[model samples]
Target: MRDTLDNLYTLDTLATFTPGVFYQFLMTKTQQFRFVKLGERFSSICGLPVAALLHDASLLFNCMTAEQRDELICDILHSSQHLTEFYGCIALTKPDGKQIWLEARSSPEAMPDGDIVWTGFVYDVTAREQALAQLAKSSELSRTILDNMLDSVVSINEQGIVIYANQTALSLFGYQAEELVGKNVSCLMGAHHASQHDQYLQHYANTKEQRIIGSNRVVQAKHKDNSLIPVELRICELDNAHGRSYLGVMRDLSHKLMQQQAIDQLTLQDALTALPNRTALNRRINQCIDNLALNPTQYCLICLDADDFKLINEGYGFEHGDEFLRQCARVLSDFGLYFLARTGEDEFAVLLETSEGRPSLEQQLGLIVQALAKPQQVFGDLISCNFTAGAFCFSTADFTYSDVVRSAELALHYAKSGGKGRIAFYDHRLDQHQRQHALLDQYLRTPDILSQFYLVYQPQYDVAGHLLGFEALMRWRHQEQAIAPDVFIPLAERNGAIFMLGKWLLQQACQFIRQAQKIPALAHCRVSLNISARQFASAHFTDEVLTEIRRSGITHSLLHLELTERLLLENPKDVVAKMQLLNRCGITFSLDDFGTGYSSLAYLKQLPLHELKIDKSFVRDLPVNSSDRSIVSAILLMAGGLDLEVIAEGVETELHRQSLQQLGCRRFQGYLYGQPMRAEHWLQH
Candidate 1:
């Protein structure tokens, strides 16, 4: 009975508490209780014999300190108000130098008398607490990173419904978090993609792919204001414990696109003319050429160069030159049949579309020339200028667009060499001539060819076969070959060699006239020297001519400056004013090549002139063509009314001379009297 009672008390009371804590408490208080009889009594009351239980108090003491064992017993006993009602026992102890958290529950068969309890279980909760702490830390880190991201982050399910959105995502779409939480992703994309959204989704589903996933893609998205906004998007797929989802990181590209457009505009525009520069022009021309290759139609490439443009810039100023270029661009744009581009500082190019198989580029060239002839006002001074243009038509199988441009450029060179403000069409012969002219231009700059130039005097006769005056003409006696005035004069003008040449001719003409004035037979005779348009347009032209007249010690009236009608037409009012000013200083003027220009009679009447010379074309056909006869009669009648003397040029036949004398023309010039001779020979004649 004693053994059984001891066992009952031991089993019942001890099992109600955690075995580790209980045993630890017993080891610390071993002197307080003699174990066998009490344990047997406790076990019998708990319904288990004492021999059935095992107690290792010494080993329990090795696992915990005395203070730990004491604190465990105090908490268990003090927890009677709560733990005692639900659990038979609750224990706490320090094991492995840390707090050991444990709980135990006992069977409900205990009595009020000091009886033992039984049927309790215990568990360690430290591993579970550590796991929960780690999980909470990971969750906080993820939330922090998502909130601070710069790019808008959005998540959607397979149904295209928005499951999650970060702050940036909500702000970018102009929606509040609550407003967008359950909305479809297509709501932000607006109607543009809404109609086709199902198709896109189907495509993706069929291919099991996404175009933007894991890469940057440009796309359009809708804002809260229902405007489409360009955006760069990067999408990624995510698989987690919850489910599969997609993440889209979007960046607005509106400002970036605007900047790119600005850059492109600057790169393609000419800084001076504000037109498409060479880079842009080439690109457009190439594109047009490629298109034409597929269609094979005739096209025209027109190349234009401002004649004597550098002289204007250097003589006037860069500001005035820039104004001139601007006006040129404006006039070219008015043509309205082609696109104009500035190919160089003073060069422009035009591309035109022509009707298939039409060879009517001449009309277009005429229109261009007419347009450029309009007068322009620059820097409080009215100035008129003209351009030389060349055109090539791609009408045959051998010609390409590039060939057309090249040919057009070559033709432009020819037109400039022939005379500026003229149009030349592309021909195979002209190409060879252009190449030779280019070589001549390079070699003709030497001083030998330049200094060897001389003047020949042609005798001018009155109606009674009396010599009036000698007209001075220039000739170049090259070392190897004789260069005609027609050839070398233009080359010299283009190469800027004409200025020096003109000065030399002016001095020689003045000296010769002074010497002729000394001859008793030629006492009243005057000498006429032909002045080029380039020389007349010089800034120092008036001063140089006046100084040469003064140095010759000859009367200014004895020196006559002959200028072509075309020169006066270039800035008519200005030329009239300049000529009138020079005339005031005793210089004389002659309108050379009359009836060849488009100037009105009113314009010609305004010019200060002493003589009008009928052009060679009219005089050459005077004996045959009735129209030429009528034109000559009309011009002589008009000059008679204006009190202007009429000089018939190219009077090569006796009929032309006799007919001109009968028409009341006082002056006659040409080989009929005598061809141009050396200055010494003219003195003897």
Candidate 2:
């Protein structure tokens, strides 16, 4: 029976033991048996006070297997710490995987064998281990949900102090979770928002309200490196048991701002030159005018228009023209302290600021003229084009910025009308006259003006007083009045009507050539027609002259083309080449107004010429002015040396002719012989 009881305890079979067996064992016991007090020591396993074992406990003398008793002893020894402290019985497993249990007095005492024992109960712990595994699974699931959340869950108190932050929040702020836990939310608000931040919080605290809660608002935040970054922040209030808190989610805005700035810059600037375009120019001008209004000092506005700019474009093509304009802009920028802008295709404007009550305006104007007069080389062509500028100075007594600009433009028109390469200051008289001239220029382009244009032949005679040839001079017989070539020629050039007018003159001259050929006396003489500078620059001029000659069926040698010295000087190489080509084709060239330009003996030698026409200015007082006499004498000597013919133009007096004839000038044309007259009149004479 003792062995069976030990086996039951060892096998954890206490519940399977029958109550009848316990009674039988108790009755069969030879010693007194009684319930001992519950185990006295506190139980480490059950966490309950040990009960004393009952008194008069029954002791059976029945023998048991040594293995069973050994098992009981092992359990007692294994659990001795708890058992000796008067706790319930405890069991343990040995390294061999053997199970054991112990039962003895609740308060075990040391026996003569020097061993301690305890009485208690034993049970298995497998069910408790299973319960612990279930708890761990639940805890892991809660942690996984918190870590994977997308929203930057930054927890802050009502005072805007950060308490807890998730991985998302830490990453957004460029910080670790531990670094941000105690930081104040205001630390991230940029300096620009620092002052207003307290008010915002105060308002929120007073009203229990939130401005950006659950909605996006632009805000600034500082990164871990202390750089300010723009962000779109969305805050949500959390109603947790831990009191009022806020969760913030921030989105960066650096990329959006960069894109917007790029678009703005591209829209405001010119892509080709990177200069401010018209839109930006207008804005800047307006701003400058506004600022100028405050001081009301002298401000000058000048407008520049390139002379014969169209010729350049037509000669070199538009691509070259564009490059030319860019180069011009770079050169123009060298002028100091001026607001220079390209206002039209070949027109530019400069706004100048002057000192108070200074009379240096004229000096400044001269400087500007000098700067513009400098030659520019474009596309391997040495271009010496000139500009006509019109200037207007602002006075509190007179005009606003707009009015000044308009006045300057009018003056520019006047300058161009007077003759190119000149500057005109704004004047009311000139402006009115310019308007009338503009109207006349418009009328001159009509067919009536074209048909009314006629030529008069000025008779040329040799020193022997025999008729040589007649120079055809263009005259415009306006229906209302007569206009001089000097006035209308420039107008025609300005309006680009010179091309057509020049062709008409050439054809008229050709007709005169045929008429002269029919006349017995003048048939042997060659007729000369003066070609304008504008005509020489025209692309189709050569073809037009050739066509007229062919239509007339007159010999090319009979038609002499006269060009002024100024025309040759304008583009010397081109002029020389063109004249050489025509000379090769049996046409003659006469250098008219020879002494009026920068005449070089070297150039004269190189030029293809048959005659040198002395300008009327020198010939008008030829025998009186020693300078004029010396020039005429020198020219005649030079022409003789070069084997070139000499024609004395503007021969208004008999002495003028006599003096020129004495100098060996063989040809002469002027009022002394006969004033320019119609071809019919020349035939009648």
Best by TM-score: 2
lDDT against the true structure, each candidate: 0.69, 0.66
In the range 386-473, model 2's lDDT, one tens digit per residue, is: 8788987764534434466668888898788779888888898976777767877998778766877788899888888888888988
Can you give the lDDT of residue 159 in candidate 2? 77
RMSD of each: 35.1, 37.9
lDDT of 1 at 276: 75
| Tens digits of per-residue lDDT for model 1, 500-611 | 8889999999999888887887877788888888888887988898888888899888888898877877877668777988899888888888898765788777878899
Error of 2 at 643 (Å): 0.8
- TM-scores of the models, in the order given: 0.47, 0.49
